[model samples]
Target chain A: MKHYQAWCFDLDGTVYRGETAIPEAVRLIGQLRDSGSRIFFITNNSALTPQMQAEKLMRMGIRAAPEEIMTSSIATAGYLAGQYGRMDVTMIGEEGLREALEEAGHRIVTEGGEAVVVGIDRQISYDKLAAACLAVSAGAPFIATNGDLAFPDERGLVPGNGAFAGLIGSVTGVQPVVIGKPESHMIAEIARKQGLRKDGMILVGDNYETDIKAGLRFGIDTLHVDTGVTRKEALAGHSEQPTYSLRSLSEWEI
Target chain B: MKHYQAWCFDLDGTVYRGETAIPEAVRLIGQLRDSGSRIFFITNNSALTPQMQAEKLMRMGIRAAPEEIMTSSIATAGYLAGQYGRMDVTMIGEEGLREALEEAGHRIVTEGGEAVVVGIDRQISYDKLAAACLAVSAGAPFIATNGDLAFPDERGLVPGNGAFAGLIGSVTGVQPVVIGKPESHMIAEIARKQGLRKDGMILVGDNYETDIKAGLRFGIDTLHVDTGVTRKEALAGHSEQPTYSLRSLSEWEI
Candidate 1:
């Protein structure tokens, strides 16, 4: 029932599932944009570039600029830049993560590095994992883009970036600093980058553990929708309730 | 010192470390073989084929037949064969694992398998991992050749089969049946294959955790040599001690 200056929407379940876009979410997002609210698309998918994400949104008739997208890869890069400035990094990820690191002025190396960053790499090889383990064991700062163990594909849930990071952590006896949902790094990065106040920003998502928890930890109001991972009935299981829970975004008042 | 009918020696730290052979271990193995004791070389390495391992031992002046080597890969194949009786399996591993599975009459499929097997694969790819995850999550039995998280190479400790299996397990939320040292499966398989009794068998190794624990759990006499992972001083840390502890194999009387 409350109007927010900034509206952060989760992809996948909130806006689209696979290739299909939710009409209710699309309508709500359009209404929010028309009402002069800043729109941000936040996702834990580190494999795709912001441009690629924006293109996906565009396909669903949702207009979003590449700059408006805050992927875990971008957040990881921003977080690393803020903490250690430019770093010599060793990475295990796709083009998106590599681009983000490069854009943040970090040099990517094969073996020894100042930081070891891992993301979802579909082309992941044993050599890449071995290099990451060696670097992390050598005391380099280990950073993971996200901690998602699995994500749904056409067939079923497949291994995510967290699994790869977990493997490296298990081998090296080192826990990586996760930079995705349920940690609030992405929300904080969005707030800091846009110079937005937490009180004026709200996160809308379908996942309770990731989206709602992220918003709560970042001190922002979270609106939970039932279009994705978590259902409305599942909300009763969590002690910490979201600011608002709706069956669909169509139920929300602009 | 009591003489055993069967002498099972762990490679790597026991017989050799890297490329060089441990002189005392080589002499002791020779003496044990000449005394008509059944000689077996047990290792958790699933990447190298039995023939390759035998060749490595031969290079160190220790003659070993391919059939005498009982690697985790062979044990895993044996375990699966006994449990499921030759299944269509999906796997993430290299030559050794493939050979064992094929030799055991199990068909290796890309997806939709009755079982899923994992091992240390230097050529590991994301597609292979994803397929394994899909199969395991779809209710296929998950098996790991070994649970050694990290193994020593020239550079340092790198990710092992356990790390890779851990990745898949984390994604699928399924624990794999490990067939390696410290689990006693390899020892059990060797016993079954050679028709040897536990009372007549003695396991010799440099690592207290893997070697000694395997022998102990398998109900056999264990001799721990202070040549590799667990030092003699560190043996006091474990509440369950090895049956015999020696500074080296040279300390043992024939």
Candidate 2:
């Protein structure tokens, strides 16, 4: 199981529920760490920052250093910074967006910026939409973290970045180059960040469509665990064919 | 509830499941029909032909007439016919694609003649991909049905039409204007074919991101059921709320 130097895990359905911790998941992480495997949680959920994710992990009895978490928001900001340095960014988001950009070495500003970086702006207004469209049309590269149209939470669901991307994509005639899980950029970043080769990196998660298929997209070994949403019958019939299937992540032999 | 004269429902996750009758769903359709509401199903699943879908509906007790089902393949063929009469389309598809084009007056030949119509060529060969790419590069307008990157099945997940679009989108620098649900084109066609008016036409489906959201994209009311890839939690949090949330098609009140 530790044949790969690094192990990438997915959050939400993988490590924890929306807010609750998966005890077995925490144990598996501990096992991985004891085995000296570099652990990283590559999640597409862009709503939270890495610090928040690390804090969540700590709360769940899974010790994750701040560097151990790489979110779509961070990856997107990283990709943007790699493209252009210190560019003006018109943000339509929360603190995560601004912090990610700052961490990625880019200047974040309000209006008349060079680039429009839109995240899950829950308090989105028509005025903000109009402003974003204007920024995008004026040559601001509309950088979206992940293309998740909707995100699941305790409250139900919220329109994720993808819905906003569609609106801006329609207006700007430009689509965001997404930089999150399911895309090679995020996968590559995790691989590079942990100094682990992409070869033989096992991705463990419950969601077959996003987690398992994302592994396939990036060419990695996948072990799908039936956590929150997946059922045994559904996992049994998966044509996506994960390397291993487990009722729980703890079942895997370390 | 029957305020609109026409209603366009999507098949697959909308009306019935794979080879099974969503009986309550069928009953709802009957009620709508008895109430003088016209119904047509627009499906992007090009694996099955429109006639096949129509037959499946009848077998499932939905009793959809032959003219009531509209598949993306059929719509693609319709698109090609008006643009190029008896045009040679380099197909990356199955019998569904061929039948749709052939019935719509298109001559699917080798690599050259007029246009190259690419469909969900599951058994994608290098030769087929090359031909499709070459034809598109040679100035054929690329068209796709839906942007679904992966299709979840009983066996697992496989690349859907969105994969082909990604390939095409990667090349040619022009994204294919997808013409299926989520995109207003197919919705408009279904509405026109079913003799459904824009008003009072409610879309019932499981997937909020695609089905419910697609219905909304077309200016139609949506009824979200507890089904599809998107979970109840995800749908609940989304600010872009659907009109009605029913536990199942059975819970739908007239």
Candidate 3:
């Protein structure tokens, strides 16, 4: 397989499953780094900060700077910053989303903000959801990290940020701007930031619905791996196939 | 104007707006009660108990018995009790829902329930939402008190139980069976309890969407008042008009 200048990898299923790093993916990333290839970690998880993500990768023997991680939270903040110019944001999320907006020089207010940003909040309350609905109804711009309805947890698939966003949307009758995979906002932002062309960028991940779909939507080559969520057998039924499908990173010659 | 044996009135917007009673509605209800008309107050609100609703009506100088009050909570509990035969229920609601379920001899559990009932819960948290989603995904019957997306609050409109139910439904891909206005569930329960036929019942309210629609769907005559929500002018645009449209309850002579 030919190497690309920009290799965007999905963190959760492709590189690591829960706490353990996939050995084949780890070796491939290490080899890509040695060959001076630009590597970026893209994730839909908006609960942890980019630094936390980088630290987790480092523990798995992967060298990653905080800037090398492009979380949905970061992409959302960047989108809002570009459109609204560091406006006051009323957010319902955790440290990751909070830090991303703050890093973008945006103020977080309790009420009457210019925008309402939603992410996965384990501590989510009715009051927070009410406030978001009120703000959105009062003409505040609604922005969501991702549109994933559910995510795999210890107990099975649990409600995600998209579910909460859907609640607020149903209440206020306002659709939010989603800034994660399957939408291509994150990929577009990464390409714009790195001064790279879409043709020179390639996305590698396990999930065809989110990671591969994002790459396809962003006009880039996508490599679907059978390590997680979407099995290789599931791809046959889909009309639009990924650019390449591999069993594991070990199969791909870097 | 002729008076009916059964007078079903919508509490919010029709009888009272927020806390204060609409004087015209109050007087009409008083007159109807003096004439020995069967009065039943119907509300989409599942937060307060029937006794509490009766007390609220009494404060507005509108004489109402606890038996005359029928909330979405009561309908939901009744529906569950009849179908599942006092089965264990996992609920996300307040006192109204709790009391109704208990009164129906249904056991309320935190998890591993046969049904998941959702009502208006002001103290709603992520844990509660997660539990509800988990139960629903696990094949528990999903039932919601109402489908009202938002309700008027001190700070404008706030997200209602339907919004939260919508959130859970979006996550689990399971639509909840709504037991409130526009569904005819509550009205059917009222009809069955009073031993009254649909032809003898008359539903009076200001809202065309919930009040009139409920009556129309239940095969009952509906009286639409222009005191709140649906204005008198707005009724002309609707293809299916109410059985009787009046400026206020004061217009009807018994």
Candidate 4:
């Protein structure tokens, strides 16, 4: 791969598959870090905090700092802080989203908030959903961390944050502002935070629909790896092609 | 209304509105009962059992039997019984759904079920949704009691059974077989139970989307009253209008 100032990587399939690390990806990331290229781990997963994500990467033999991690939750937090300013928010998510919102100086209230933010919540309940609907209908801003309909786990693909968001949106007749992949919000926020332009940024991921589309939509170059959800053949249907399509991360050279 | 042997009425908007009985509806129902016309109360609400619905009607001064009540739960149970026979099923609903399934001789399993049934569940949880998604991804037949996206509550419109079902459907990439209004399944089942033809039945209600649409789709006559969701002006937008439009139930004569 040609040198880019910002090398944004997608987790799950791009850096690791489930609990195991992709050696080629880990090696490439290390090389990129050694060469002084700014690395950011971008993940749609809002279930884990940046610290947790960095720790996960570290366990896979890839040195990563919490500051270098850009989860959907973090992006959502940044987006809210930048766009809506400090606001009391009702949330439906896990520790990651809660921490990010609180860290960004937003109060997380149970009800009657200025905004309703939704992320992947394992302890999701009807009451939470009801509260969200009530808030949204009452004119509160509705925001979703990511729009990933499902995520693969040991039990196979389970309902993700987007599914719940969709449910709320359908019920309340209000569309949530999604701040994850396939939307330019995360990439734009990352670029804004780092003081870089789209020309110097390159997004690497296995999923063409989210990662590649995000990069393409953000006006940045994208590299597609076949180790995830989208295979080489599947890209044939899409009109827009990525900058590079590699069989593995090791196949690309700086 | 002209003499129709089978008088199917939608409960919420047609008969009563949030615990208070509509006086005209009560009077009309009483007259129908006195004239020996079979009265069937249909509801998209799967939260209550037929007994509960009947009791609620009885409290509203409208005598009703459990057998005369046709809830989405009952229709769902009948659909499953007729299609899949005795099979293990996963459920995301309340007491009504559980009772109907069990009474229909279907085993309700936590996981590894032959079907995944959804209904109006106030106590819905992530675990329930996750289990449903996993089972559906594993090729379980997905079924929803009704497709009412939202329903009016004390706090305004809240997420209904359809919203939850839509969430699971989005996650698992499976469409659920709805057994409520606008699909004609409940009406058809009711007609079958009464051994009556669609031509001989008339569905009366306030909502055009659910009640009138159900009758129209079932190839029966429909009576629209300006009592609920769809107003009279909104009916002008619909190409297929109800067989009768009344200002109130008192305006109709048997």
lDDT of each: 0.92, 0.72, 0.91, 0.90
- Deviation from native of the Cα of residue B224 in model 2, angstroms: 40
Q: Which should have the higher lDDT, number 2 or number 3?
A: 3
Chain B of candidate 3 achieves a TM-score of 0.97
**Residue A10: error of model 3 in Å?**
0.6
DockQ of each: 0.90, 0.02, 0.79, 0.84
What tens digits encode model 3's per-residue C-alpha lDDT throughout A10-106?
Answer: 9988999898999999999889988878999999989889899999999988788998899999999999989989899999999999999999999
Candidate 2, position B89, lDDT:
71
Which scores greater on DockQ, model 1 or model 2? 1
Ranking by DockQ: 1, 4, 3, 2
| Model 4: per-residue Cα lDDT over B115-194, one tens digit each | 99999888888888899999998898899999889988888888899999999889988999999998888888888888
What TM-score does prediction 2 earn? 0.49
lDDT of 2 at B104: 79
- Total backbone collisions for each predicted model: 0, 18, 0, 1
lDDT string, candidate 1, A1-254, tens digits: 78899999999899998898899998988899999999999999898899998998999888899999999999999999999899999999998899999998999998798899999999888898888989998999999999999998889999999999999999999999999998899999889988999999999999999999999999999999999889899999999999999998999998
TM-score of chain A, all candidates = 0.98, 0.90, 0.97, 0.97
Docking quality category of candidate 1 according to DockQ thresholds = high
**CAPRI classification of candidate 3:** medium
Worst 10 residues of 1 chain A by lDDT: A122-131
Clashing pairs in 3: none
Question: Which of the predicted structures, 2 or 3, would earn the higher DockQ when compared with the native?
Answer: 3
Off by over 4 Å in 1: none
| Second chain alone, TM-score for each candidate | 0.98, 0.87, 0.97, 0.97
